[model samples]
Target chain A: MSEPIAGAPNGEPLSSDRPPAPSPEEAIRPDGRWLAQVEAASGVKAGACYGCKKCSNGCPLSFAMDLHPYQVVRYLQLGQMDKLEGSSTVWICASCQTCLTRCPNQVDLPRLMDWLKEELVRRGQAAPEEKVRLFHQLFLKGVAKRGRVFEGELMAGYMLKTGGAFGPEAIKNARLGLTMLKKGRMKLLPERNKDRRWLKALFREPKGGSHA
Target chain B: MPEVSYYPGCSLEATAKDYAESVEGVCEALDIELRELPDWNCCGASAAHSLDHRAALNLGARNLALAAQGPSPLVVPCALCYNRLASARHELLEGDDLVIDEIKALGGGYAGVEVVELNDYLSSPEVTALAKQRATDLDLSGLKAVCYYGCQGQRPPAVTGKADYENPQGLDRLLGALGVTVMDWPFKTDCCGASHSVPRPDLVFTLVAKLYKRALDQGANCIVTGCQMCQANLDMYQEEIAKQMGKQVYLPVLYFTEVMGLALGIDETPKWLKRHLVSPKGLLEKAQLPRQTWERL
Candidate 1:
C-alpha cells in the first residue's frame, strides 16, 4: 500500500522542518499589531480560530507542508512571522479552498495564504517551493504577453529556467507531451488577442509607470 | 433555440481541446446556441490571485466587461475559469469601486454579467428535459461513474453561490436522467491538486491516486468530471500512479459533456473520446455504446 501520509518524495519526514512549538509563556503574549495587520490586509480574523484543526484536517496538501493550515493561522495570531515566512506551508498551499470550506468559523485561509505569498514575493524572500512560485510567475508572464497562455512556450520556458529540460521529470513526461501533440491537444503556435493594449496597461507597474 | 454567451477559457484553445469540442457537440445537440464572447482574454487562473490580487480581479473584471456586452449569463466550461470569473464579478459588484474604476479607465464597466458553471447550467430543468427528450434511445447503463466535482467548480459558497456546495448533485442528477449509473461517492468535491501538476506532480499523483482507488472501491469503472484540469490530472497520471502503487488502478477519466454527447448519439463522440490520455473505449464498448477507434500516438 502507498504510504498513508504520502511522505515527501525525498524521504524527509514531513514534520522535520516544522518550527518548534512555542512555550506557554510565549503563547500568552499575543502580537496585537501583527494580528491587526494580517486581519486588515486579508480581511480574515485569525483570532477567531480556536484551534479546531478542521482546516488542517481537511487540507489535501497538508501532508507536504511544514506548518499545518491551522498552525499558519496560529502563527499569525502569535506574531510568529519568522516561522510563517520560512515555512513551506504558504508555497505548498494549492489554494484549493477545502480548508475555508470546512472551517466552522468560515475563516478564509486560502485568501490569507494568497496574501502571504504576495507579501513574501514583495519582501524578496525565497519560497521553499521555488518551482511552484516559478510556475505561477511564468504562467502570469504568458498571460500578460498574449492575453492567453501558450502551453508550448510556457512549458519550454519553465523547463529551461528550472534546468529541468533533461531531468527525470522531463523524460517521464516526454511521452505524455508527444501524445498531446499527436492528439492536437498541445498547440504549436500561440493564440493572440486582437486588442492587447488594455492587457498591457493592466500589467504595468502603477508607482513607476513601468512595464512588469 | 436558447442563446447564451460562452467563455471558453485559455485551456480550451489547446490542452482542453477535447473538452471544447465535446461541449460544442453537446450544446448543439441540445439546441443551445453559444455566442462566443469576442476577443475574450485569460482569467489569470491561480497565478494572478497568488501573485497580485488587483491584477486577478482586474483580469476577471475585464472578461466580465466583455461578457456583459453580449448575454445575460456567461457559460464557462472550465471550473477554474468559472471560479475566477464568478469570484471577480462578486468582488467587483460588492467589494469596492477600485476595480470598477480600473475597468472604466480601460473602456469598460462592471456590466454585472452573470456567470454560470456549465455543468450547473446544463443540469437545469429545461436543459435536462431537453436532454431526456433527445436521449430516448440512449442506454449508458454499462458505465458506472463517480462524478468528481474538483474544487472551484463549487466551493467557497460566498462566491459560486452553490446551494449544494458540500455535496453537489448537478452531475449526478444530469447523468441519472441520461441512464448512466452515477455512484454516490464522498470524493465529489475533492481537490485534484489544480495547477500543482506542473510544479508538484508527486502531490497530484498522490491525490489523484487516492481518488482513483476510492472510485474503484466504490465499484466505479470510470470518473466523470466537468473541469478540464481535473480530467487531465486524473487521466494523465493514472499510469504513473499505478506504477508507483504496484497495482492495477486503471480508471477512464472522462469529461461530462463527452458522456452526454455519446448518450445523445452525437457523431463527434468517438472523435472526442479518441483524444483522452486514458481511453474510455473499453467501458463504452462494454456498455454497447459506439465503438471508438484509437489513434496510435
Candidate 2:
C-alpha cells in the first residue's frame, strides 16, 4: 500500500490549505472528469444524485458509516476520491441495495460502493473496515476453489484471518457452530463442481477487458 | 402441471437442510414437480457481487445456461441465490453491450429462461388453489406468525422484480391461504444482517434483536421467513438475543415451506420442524395445528 500523503485519508490530497478541513458539504468542488469516471466505472449517474438523502435515511448501517449514502454520492459528485477512500462508508456497505430501491434518481449506491471497493483494493490501500473486506475476499476465494461454500471451511478461514481463532470470540462462535452441527445444519464436507476450470476462469480478468 | 427447475444453492444442502426438506414436502403436496438443476454451483451471492462483479455474474449466468437447457421456470429457494441468478440475467439484458458479449461467451447465452423465486411460484393462483385443497385436512389458523422477507427477496427491482418490493405479500398470502394468521409488522422486508451472522455477530445480534422485539410486540407466536440466511440468523440467535434482552424470549423462526408443509399434512412434519435451533413443536402444539402422525414425541 502507498504511504499516506499529508492531509489525505488514503492518498490524494485536498486542493485547499489543510488545517481543520471543511465539512463535506462546504468542500464540494465540481470535477467533471471525476463525475464521468465514477459514472463510467459504476454505471451509475453520479450527476443525478441531486442531494436527496433518501438513500441515507433508508440505509440500515448509515449510523455506523463515516459518510452516509448521500455523502458518498456528494464525494462522487465532486470527484473526491480521497474523501471516499478515507471514509468507511464504502468499505462498510453491506450491499443490501436498500439505497438502490429508494433512490428517486435511480442511483445505484450499492453498485457505486462495489466500484469504490474495487478501486481501494486496486490501489492496495488499507480498507477503512478490515473484517468486511477480508470476509468478501475469503467468500469469493472459497467459491472459486470449491463450487460451493462450506460454512465450516468459510468460518475457519475467516476466524484464522481475523484473529478469531484461539480468541474468545472463536469459542463463542464454536458454541454456535456446535449447536448448528447437532441440528445437522452444517456439513463437514464441501461439495465441489465436476469441472471447476470454467468457474475458476471467471474470476480472472479477461485480456484488455474492464471488469466494471 | 409444469415441472419447475429447482436450484437449492449451497446453503440448502447444509445449513438449510430443513428448508430443503420442507420445501420438497410442500412442493409435492402442491403437485409442483421440481427438477433439481443438474450439478448447480454457488450463486456467489452476499459476497461475490461485492468483490468481483464479473465473476459473480458469470457464476449466476452459468446456472442460467444450465437451466436453459431444460424446460422449466428456474425455481430458486434461497433468497440470495434468487437474487444472484435473477440479477445476472437482468444485468446481461440491461448492462453494457461489451460486458454482455463477454458474459454470453463465458457462461453461454441463455434465452427465455425465467428465474422465479420459490415464494412466488408457490403463491401463484393455481398453486394456491392446490395448496388450499391439500391443506383442507390440516389446521393452522390458530397459529399467529410474522413473515420476514429480508433483503434479496425484494430489493433492486431489476433483479427480484417482485411486484411489491416495499411490502411483499406473496409469503403473506401463501401462509394466509394455509390458515396462518400473518401479522401486520413493519419490519417485514428489512435486512437481517445476512452474512454478518458471521464475522460480526455483534451487528447481527442488534439487527436481529429489533426483529425479535417487533415480532413479540405484535404478539406473534413464531416468525416465518423465505430466505435460508434470514431463517438461520433469527432461529439460531434467539438464545443470544434473549441474553441481550435480559429476558427469556422464545420465537421459532421457520421457513415458509415448513409452515406450508405442516398445513399440507406432509408425511414428515417432525423431520423439518424438529431441526430448528428454536423448536416450534411447543408453538405448534399450543396452536392446535394438526399433528396427525408424529404425536408420539
lDDT of each: 0.86, 0.81
How would you encode candidate 2's per-residue C-alpha lDDT over A1-212 as one tens digit per residue? 35456867756745555489788877767776888887887788878988879999998877678899898898788877888887888866777789999899998889888888877877777887778878888888888787788778988998887778886977987888898888888899889888677754665565654332
Query: lDDT by residue for model 1 over B1-297, one digit each (tens)?
Result: 889999999999898999999999999999899999888889999999999898898888888888778876899999999999988888877654557454666555454788999999999988988998898586788789999988998878988888899899989999999999989999998888988999888899888888888999999999999999998899877887899977897688889998898778787777888888887767776767644422221
Give stretches of model 1 more than 4 Å off.
A1-29, A206-212, B100-102, B105-111, B292-297
The TM-score values for the models, in the order shown, are 0.92, 0.90
Scored by TM-score, the top model is 1
Pairs in steric clash, model 1: none
Tens-digit lDDT track of model 2 for B23-83: 8888877667899988788998767887677777778777888888776799999988998
Q: Which candidate is the best by DockQ?
A: 1
* DockQ of candidate 2 (2 decimals): 0.46
